[model samples]
Target chain A: MKKVKVYVTLRESVLDPQGSAIMGALHSMDYNEVTDVRIGKYLELQIEEGTRDVDTVVREMCQKLLTNTVIEDYRYEVEEAVSK
Target chain B: MKKVKVYVTLRESVLDPQGSAIMGALHSMDYNEVTDVRIGKYLELQIEEGTRDVDTVVREMCQKLLTNTVIEDYRYEVEEAVSK
Candidate 1:
């Protein structure tokens, strides 16, 4: 099997309300050292053997469903899964 | 400033309902090559200079708020942030 690690983040031009809320909460909690926060999604996928060219397949999946390409950017790393 | 990347994942012994739902969706969409899916959170923090021992502060933040240690595990990477 192949293991894929995906990171999805809002585009830089977009505003992230959830992140801002967390940042504000941290500040109120006395973590004044925090300058900014950006929250995103992380996903891991295990692909069965013989899955069509892993790279192409994963990229397509990200584009089709894993992310909202208009507002988010996603990148992934693929590795061979170790035997169980 | 320092940039910190935090990754939170469900512990191996814990079940992930969200991941399972996504996996089922992918299968219904004919991505039968997908064997497993795990979903988690990614956070990026910009830390102000002079923060008391960044490592200590970030670990505390992760343990206190960024993650739920009961069923999740978290790890982080810190790097020097580039100024705008």
Candidate 2:
């Protein structure tokens, strides 16, 4: 089996209200050193043992359903899962 | 300046309904090769130029606000931000 870690974030041009809210909260909490924040999504997928190209499968999944490509960008890391 | 990438994931003992829903969707789309899916949060923080230990500050943020200690675990990667 293989494991894939996917990270998705808003595009640079997109506005992120959630991130702004968190930034405001941080400032209110005296974490003024924080200048900016971007909130995103992380996903982990466990692929069953197969000969299929895991990278291709994962990227397809991200593009098709895991993210909204119109406003978000995504990247992923794949690793071999240790058997039990 | 420094940028911290935070990944927050649900604890192994917790149930992830959203992930299960996505997995079902994938299976409906003929992605039976996928065994499991876990969904989580990703955050990026931009710290202003400061002499304070970036690692300590980032970790504190994760523990205090970025994650729910009762059911989630978080890890972070810190990198120096490129000056424009």
Candidate 3:
């Protein structure tokens, strides 16, 4: 099996209100050193060896359902998995 | 400034309902190769140079606010940022 890790982040042009809120909270808590905060999604997928290569399958999934292409960007890495 | 990338994931003991839902959707769409999926949070913080070391500041933030210690675990990496 292979484990694919996908990271989905908002487009650079997008404004992350959630992140801004968190930054503001931190500043209030005395972490004034933090200038900015941006939040994103991280996903890990375990795939059994299939007909297509793992890379192809992951890319297809990302584009189809894992991310919103218009306002978000996604990237992934595949690693060997330790089966249970 | 330094950019700290923090990934917060549920503990192995915790369940990920969202990940399971996505996996089910993928299978229904004929992507049966995926066996399991887990979802987590990815955060990036822009930190100004402070009196304390970056590592110390990051750890404090993660413990106090970025992650819920009981159910989630967090890890981070720091990279130099291009000032605007």
Candidate 4:
């Protein structure tokens, strides 16, 4: 078996309202030293078969369907796991 | 300063399509022993000042704005750091 981890985050240029709101709230709460806030996604996937060229396939998946390239950035890592 | 970490994940009841696809990919890659996969989000926010009652404020922020309570679940933690 194999495990793939994907991380997705908004592009730097895009304004993240949720992150901004959190920053504002933190400031009001006396955590007045906060500088930047960024929000992103993390995904852990378990794959069934142990195949060759897994990295290429996973990268393609991220580009073609898993993420929005225009406004979001994604990176994935694949690791082999012991079969049980 | 204070740091708030928020983790957002799809409710167990909801189907995670991206996670499913990654599982499928893993299967095709010869990792035939894999089972369940879950996907979620992570956020790191920095606050400026160190105030009292930070936990309550951060929790409220997650409930009110940092996450969508309908389909997603969120948890957060707050920590104090040395001012620079």
Candidate 5:
């Protein structure tokens, strides 16, 4: 089996209001060393071996359903799954 | 400046309904090789070097605000940030 980890984040040009809010809150709480905070999404997928290459499958999924390309960017890593 | 990447994931015991919904959609769209999906949060923090250690700061922020320890687990990686 393969385990795919995907991270989706806002594009540099986009305004991340939520992240800004978190940073403000942190500063008020006296964690002033934190200069910035950007929040995003993390997805873990379990896929059984199939006819398609794992990389191809992941790219297709990310392009089709996993991200909003207009404002966000996504990257993924695939690895062999060890039984839990 | 230092960059801290924090990943917060739901504990295995939690039910991830959004993940299930995404998986169902993927199956309907014919990406059946995918067997499971889990969703979580990814946070990127820019921290200026200060009197306190970055690791300690990250751990404190994560415990107090970034995640709910009751139902989530978090891990972090600290690295130097390349200028944009």
Candidate 6:
């Protein structure tokens, strides 16, 4: 078995309204030191087979369907699972 | 300053297509023991002033904007940051 971790984040140039709102709320709550907030996604995948090519496949998947490359950036890692 | 951590996950009933594709790829790679993959979002907010009410405000923000409560579940935590 294999495990994959994927991270997706909005491009720096994109406007993140949710992040902005959170920043405003934080400031109002007396957490004035918070200058910014960035929101992103994470995914954990469990695969059936363990293979060296898993990383490449995962990365391709992220680029093709998991994220909008024009507005988001994604990265992933694959690890072989140890049988119990 | 205060820090808020938000975690958002798809409802159990929702079909996570990206997760499913990743699972399929893992199986093809020889990691056949894997059965499931759940994808989610995480947000970290840095606040300016530290206050007791931060947690409540952060939770409200998550409910209102950070996640889709009908299809997703979210939780948040707040911590006072130590000055460097």
- The models' CA-based lDDT, in order, is 0.94, 0.91, 0.94, 0.74, 0.95, 0.74
Tens-place lDDT per residue, model 2, A1-84, is: 888889999999999999999999989877899999999999999998667678888888889999999999999998998777
Task: Tell me the deviation in Å of residue A31 in model 2.
Answer: 0.2
lDDT tens string, model 1, B6-38? 999999999999999999989988889999999
- Candidate 4, residues A54-73, lDDT tens digits: the string is 67656766787567999999
Candidate 2 per-residue lDDT, tens place, B31-57, comes to 888999999999999998677788888
Output the number of the TM-score-best candidate: 5
True contacts kept of each: 0.89, 0.89, 0.96, 0.75, 0.97, 0.79
Which scores higher on lDDT, 2 or 5? 5
lDDT of 3 at B55: 97
Candidate 1 docks at the CAPRI level of high
Each candidate's DockQ: 0.89, 0.84, 0.93, 0.43, 0.94, 0.44
**Native RMSD of candidate 3 (Å):** 1.0
- Sort the candidates on lDDT, descending order: 5, 3, 1, 2, 6, 4
In model 1, the runs with Cα more than 4 Å from the true position are none
The deviation in Å at residue A78 for candidate 5 is 0.5
**Structural similarity to truth (TM-score) of each candidate:** 0.97, 0.95, 0.97, 0.59, 0.98, 0.59
Model 4 — TM-score against the truth?
Answer: 0.59
Candidate 4, residues B1-84: lDDT per residue as tens digits? Answer: 776777788997999987787668756864455475688988877755545466765676677767789999987777775556
lDDT of 6 by residue, A1-84 (tens): 787777788987999998888778766765555677988888877666645466665776677666899999887777775666
lDDT for B11 (candidate 3): 95
For lDDT, the strongest prediction is: 5
Can you write out model 1's per-residue Cα lDDT over A3-75, one digit (the tens) per residue?
A: 9999999998999999999899889888999989999999999998683898988998999889999999999
Q: What DockQ number belongs to candidate 3?
A: 0.93
State how far residue A69 of model 6 sits from its true place (Å): 0.7
Chain A TM-score values, per prediction = 0.95, 0.94, 0.96, 0.82, 0.96, 0.84
- Least accurate 10 contiguous residues by lDDT in model 3 chain B: B48-57
